[model samples]
Target: MQVTTTADPAEFMATAGDWLVREPVENNVLLVHALDPNGVPPGDREPVFATVTDAGAVVGTAFARSPYRMTISDMPAEAAVALAEHLAKEGEPVPGVNGPTGAATAFSARWTELTGQRVGNERAQWIMRCTETTRPVNPDGRPRLATEDDQDVVAEWFTAGMRDSGLSPEEILRRTQHMVGGQIANQRLIVWETSAGEAAGAAGWNPPLHGVVRPSGVFVSPNHRDGGIATLVLGEVVARALEDGADACVCTHFLKYESMLAVVEKVGFRRLVDVVEHIYE
Candidate 1:
């Protein structure tokens, strides 16, 4: 097996796309593609690496977008150990993050073996899927799609959502434009308003693919919390997704979102994966 680096984002994305189309669930190609497309340019960004066998078959791949942070799709235990050792020898400060718990644990263990840094506690990520339809009963307000003129407000809300979720502002902004453009193309934003025509809460969903759509930026202002505004916002977004032919919709919430969890559960969403956000220190 040989690991090679690529500087062209387009080529990397193409290769990654081919890999994903062949093994969608196994490789997490969609998530990586989305991140890469929305990521900032590699002016100073670390180069991405593709792993392939002697026969030129791609096996496992990883990329270091930011210094001290690496994201991997898959890797064997021995290859992971080798990667860790190589990074350690180069004195690279690696903080690993990814979906595969086994690979992550093995990599962390190997990193410690080489660098003497202990692994930290793992946090939980809940991947929730929408299973049933529960439209909001109180039609006290109408849902309106956001327009291009609303970019400022939308950007502010997006930044707030990212900050609330502990994402980097620069990275979030780079991704937000892509997400917002998608929202506009799909007419995905829904705003809950009061009888006075004031915005109470808002939510956005991307276009459906493979019968699935993921909702993003579900938020209610502080003054509007606990009044079922979030529930209304989510209901509108789910309804939109379903109307667009989505058989299912997904959203993620950290373990801390007790209220959000309850709202999603009440609306017929099921928990799928306990996702963890592993940050490199």
Candidate 2:
């Protein structure tokens, strides 16, 4: 197997685009980057992209950059190990790796052997899908599109959500600044309001690709968690996306977040695959 590296998103897409869409759900992150207008080198920091080929046909792909853990797509175990060796040789300080269970496990193990960096933590993730959602019970508040006036608090909740999910501090800050505004401007983010019209929580979805839409994420403040805010907002967003022509909705969440699991369950998401995220020391 040969692993090719590139800093250009277009080049990377050109090389592995076909392989990526072949298993879109498993490669959702990469596909979103390829199909986005937010620019793939988010925060203007270039990511390390790897494309694996055997007999000159693309077989696998992965990427690593600061503020985000390395993530691999459907690939052979050997390809994943080869990617670990390639990253080690290039000397990128990958903070962690997350992806489909098999590739992530193979890559993390080889990375430990090659660079002596131990796996600091392993978080199991659930990839869930909703083809049709059950209507969420109303929580006294309704969902509305976020606007510029709501940017500050939305960014705040975005950061809080990232922190709660154990994202690195730099990542939380970067995404708060770079992503929140875009989400609002594109009308992709939703705000759940109180009966008095106060912002109680937020949720959003990516533009559909291959008939699939993935929720960017959802969050309700501590004081408002009891109101079922997340379920109501996310369910509305998914329902709207389906009405807008998306065939299905998808989301990835840590298994530890029981609240999120329950919220998703209330809206009819069923587990599709098991994912893993391994942190490095």
Candidate 3:
């Protein structure tokens, strides 16, 4: 097999699209394409690789970049080792991100042998799929579009969501602001409010794609934990997606979010897959 790298996002997306259709996952393929569109300049984006057989069939793929990270789609442990070895030899900086656990472990060992770097802590990667689409009864309030004036409040909630998910607050805020300012132009930030009109929960949506959109930043404050506000927010988000001509809405939450899971199920989302994220450091 031979591995070829490309900076062209179209080529990357073409390969990625095929991989996604063959093996669907929240983080591994879908979200990556949503975040980085084809035809766009690479910017700080990483290089993508397509592993091809001598007969000219694409076998597997991977992505890697500096200041961001590298990750592999589902592939054999041996392929992972070979890819890592190639990167190490090329002096490319390895990213501390996800891959299959066994593959990552094997590659890390190979990396250490080739580059003398040590593997750091490893964390479990969870991938949750949306199954059902139930809306909550008696939603506390209505879903409203957030305005520029609400930026600070939205930023705070975004930071809180990151903290709850064990992500870096600073990085979350930076990325949030960037997203909010860009392609998210079609997105609506929905808020769940109390009888007194106090905000209880919030969620964001990506613009619809192929008649589908992904829900993002779903968060309910601790005080609103048992209030079923999440279900309301989810319902509103799904409604918006439908109204915009979308057939389905998708989102992924860390497995630690039991409450969120319950809420999504209450509103008609069913479990699609359990995804695991492997980080390399």
Please tell me which predicted candidate would have the highest lDDT against the true structure: 2
Query: How much does candidate 1 score in TM-score?
Result: 0.74
Over 4 Å off in model 3, which ranges?
24-31, 34-54, 99-109, 112-119, 164-169, 208-212, 242-248
Measured on C-alpha atoms, candidate 2 has an lDDT of: 0.82
Model 2: per-residue Cα lDDT over 91-141, one tens digit each: 777878888899899999999999888998899998888889865657577
Best-performing candidate as measured by TM-score: 2
- Compared with the true structure, what per-residue lDDT tens digits does model 3 show for residues 56-153? 55555666655344566656666667777677767777645465556556667777778766655455544444433544556446666766755667
- Positional deviation of residue 15's Cα in model 2 after best superposition, in angstroms: 1.2
lDDT of 1 at 122: 60
Q: Where does candidate 3 have its weakest 10-residue lDDT segment?
A: 34-43
Candidate 2: residue 134 Cα off by (Å): 3.0
* Per-candidate TM-score against the hidden true structure: 0.74, 0.94, 0.76
Winner by lDDT between candidate 2 and candidate 1: 2
Q: What's the CA RMSD for each of the models? A: 4.0, 1.8, 3.8
Q: Which whole-number lDDT from 0 to 100 does residue 103 have in model 3? A: 55
